[model samples]
Target: MQSGKFKTFYLPLAAIAAIIAGLALSFAWAAGLLGHRTTTRTFLGDSLQHFEPGYRRAHGKGICFTGVFRSSGAAASLSKARFFSQQEFPVIGRFSIGAGDPHAADTSTTTVSMALLLTADDKSQWRMKLNNAPYFPTRNAEGFLAQRSAFEPDPATGQPDPVRVAAFFKEYPEARKAVEYKATASSPSSFAGAQYNVINAFVLLAADGKRQPVRWSMRPRTTLGSLSAGDRAKASRDFLFDDIKQRLAIAPLYWDLTLQLAEAGDPIDDPSQPWPEERKQVIAGTLAVTGVHDQAAGGCRDINFDPTLVPPGIELSNDPVLAARAGIYAHSYNARLREIGLGKATEAVGHGDSH
Candidate 1:
């Protein structure tokens, strides 16, 4: 009788204990056991972790410069931001290739990029991230990761496996637009001549609290120019730097900041879907690139061109990739900081050959 009583009570308790233990294990496994962003359903941290090896924790590689941002006060009508006024502030800028690797080749690389950090007297700042390409490789962070995984180089070949890349395109057909665009746009001859775009959309607010979804770009005052294959083949590794340095000696470069208003049916949330060319465009301001500098000691070397760092009158959109960029960049930055503390890095992060 006593044995039966003990057996019934203990058996039930043991079963309950097993269930609780299993649940605890499951929770732990789900938290991080799957791996970083690639394997698990997580946020920016995980997605950014995958890029550490490929990018060397630099996020994006470029050369830094310093200049002046001249405002026509025209953008104030579009958005009442202080920088859009007639005020002139010191500008820190960067010129880069698309790859994240700091040491990537300069001469033959096709994707050109520019970053501007417009700072005010009170330390408030506006950052504009512009790329030469009109379209990005992937639409969102999910597509970005899928593209990265597919583009992983074969260890022996040291190049992307064409089969995997083809399969990736099959799976995510949206990436084809970017692939085609890049195919047509070889690297331009000089940074001063190529147009740069703020492909991501933002809501610019007038002082009256009305907001408008808008996209913006900077068109070079100089006519757009591209290099021929022969020029690229015969160029030195530091050709871009040499050219820009020589170019700056002649005159300050210029680009007009053109902001486009989104019409009805235009996709404001999806940066991958560009607005039609016929959309209403306004010349918000002018960007005068007065000078250039080396990344090692320039203002842009240490700064992140935060997408959401707008003043009071500008608001960020609900674009997922744009949202994730801030966090991902923070993660990349902290990782690099830790790596640098451990003596794995030098002070020059986005330094070019000229540095």
Candidate 2:
């Protein structure tokens, strides 16, 4: 009788234990903590997480984003070179902040950003990550990468030591600007008022094979929709992920992707020089975020948005950073792909549809 009673309880307990073990295994797989998969997942997570503190440092609060895609009714009049046009393809937009690591709270006051992109014939996407503001304080991508790597914590302490940051900032001018920007920005409201810029450094090619330098801008539909001070203080680190998930759940986040085409003889290389608003030709296009891709589920993590994936009509115009990014992004993507057993990635539209 005692054996029968013990068996009854033990069987249920054993079953429960098995279920729990299975769940833990699933979580491990999802987190990419299993074997070689861990490397790829960790790299992607590190890249995204790298932005968190920078977002808080810049925005003074946290981060939030909305992504929208083009609706079918709208006409895509974006010009193209060669036989391909920018209008023919559909796009996916990923809006984020220039700062804020994956671990930091998304509600931090970093600059709001968006990447509007379209799928090319080759299955590669052509996307441009843009900020709400008009200029990037960093001198170049290499400089940006160096500062970011340094800003991360010292492995020994696992804490962000001010002394280390100070030493890094001593060499990086942009880090100095960041320090100054944060020193004075005491309140979230003060930081919210800070104008963010998406430094334009890419060239758009027209149907005539002419290259026009471009800067893109997207102003909020309503300035009243900004986060409150309380929101910042109470927000979770995943505020951006949550905010975007909620917004995309209800109404689509809408933004105008305005292109300011540069005139002839304008310098194409230097992004520091702002094109006069009057001289900037605006080609207005609507960006609608239909859905938020899951970062945890390999949506945002598995891919690299290489700007070289230009559609037919859009061409690269000797932008040094763009050229460098093309190679770097390609290598990184391939590395992650190889580690994850994902195989090689396809190239963007260029030749025939052999991709």
Candidate 3:
């Protein structure tokens, strides 16, 4: 009778322990601590191919700028953020090419980016990282990893296999849409000519507790222009940076901060899908880029420019890629900081020998 009671009790306890162990394993797998993990380090490694100790793993080529954002008070109805209160905020900005190598020729890559950190008088900050592309190429982080894997250069050919690339597009139709968009869109001749978009959606909370989903873009005041084939061939490796410096020297560059309000049917989670053109847009403010400087001159070098770093009235959306970016940026920032601390890297690096 005692033996039967022990068997019943012990069996249930064993089962319970097994269940707890299984749950732990499941959580570990989901967190990417087990199995085949796709981590931020993996992305950094893939982006650079060979690590450049002191530089960023991606967008390694860049110049800094000092600016001011003058709010129009138009977006005050949508958000209680202080920066939208018809006041001027000091801004530190960076313009970068989306190339892995710091010394990459400007003409070699069409992808460019602008990142800004705007600070209000009360010390509230709005950090934005924008891309020239209106929409992202992949819908989620997994799709991004797959896309990178597909395009990884083969050892023998020094280019990705056509079959693999074709297969990737077949599997992820959204990527093809982005490629098609780029193919048809005219290339910007100068950095000032490109419109930089914040592809991720964010929720703007007003004083009345009303929440509005929105995306924003920095629409250039400068007219869009294109470089001829001959011009591109003769362009220096730092042509884009050089052009921006020359332009700023003549006069300040300006961009209108346009906020797009999401309609009921808009997809807030999928950055690969753009909203309809009919959506309502509000000109929140104007950004004046007054000056440009090298990273060594100490303007925007230490700023991480994490998209999730917003003021109190702004909150992150459910977009997986946006969520993943925060962690990835934190990791990258911390890793680089550690490297800099250990003297394994230097903070003042990049911008075509300006260091």
Find the candidate with the highest TM-score and give its number. 3
Residue by residue across 1-355, what tens digits does model 3's lDDT show?
Answer: 9999999999899999999999999987655455434655576556436356656667877888999999999999889999899489899999998787767888877788999999998899999999998899888877888888898898999999999999999888889988788766654589999999999999999989999999999999999678887887888878898899899999999999999999997999999999998899999999999999886564576789999899999999999889778766765666666665677764446222462
On residues 261-309, what C-alpha lDDT tens digit does candidate 2 reach at each position?
Answer: 6777766665545667787545355555566653323144334555666
| Candidate 3 backbone collisions, by pair | none
Question: Which is superior by TM-score, 1 or 2?
Answer: 1
Where does candidate 1 stray beyond 4 Å?
A: 1-61, 153-167, 347-353
> Which window of ten consecutive residues has the lowest lDDT sum in model 1?
50-59
Q: What is the TM-score of each candidate against the true structure?
A: 0.79, 0.58, 0.86
Q: What lDDT would candidate 2 get against the real structure?
A: 0.50
lDDT comparison, 1 vs 2, better candidate: 1
TM match of model 3 to true structure:
0.86
What is the number of residue pairs that collide in model 2?
Answer: 32
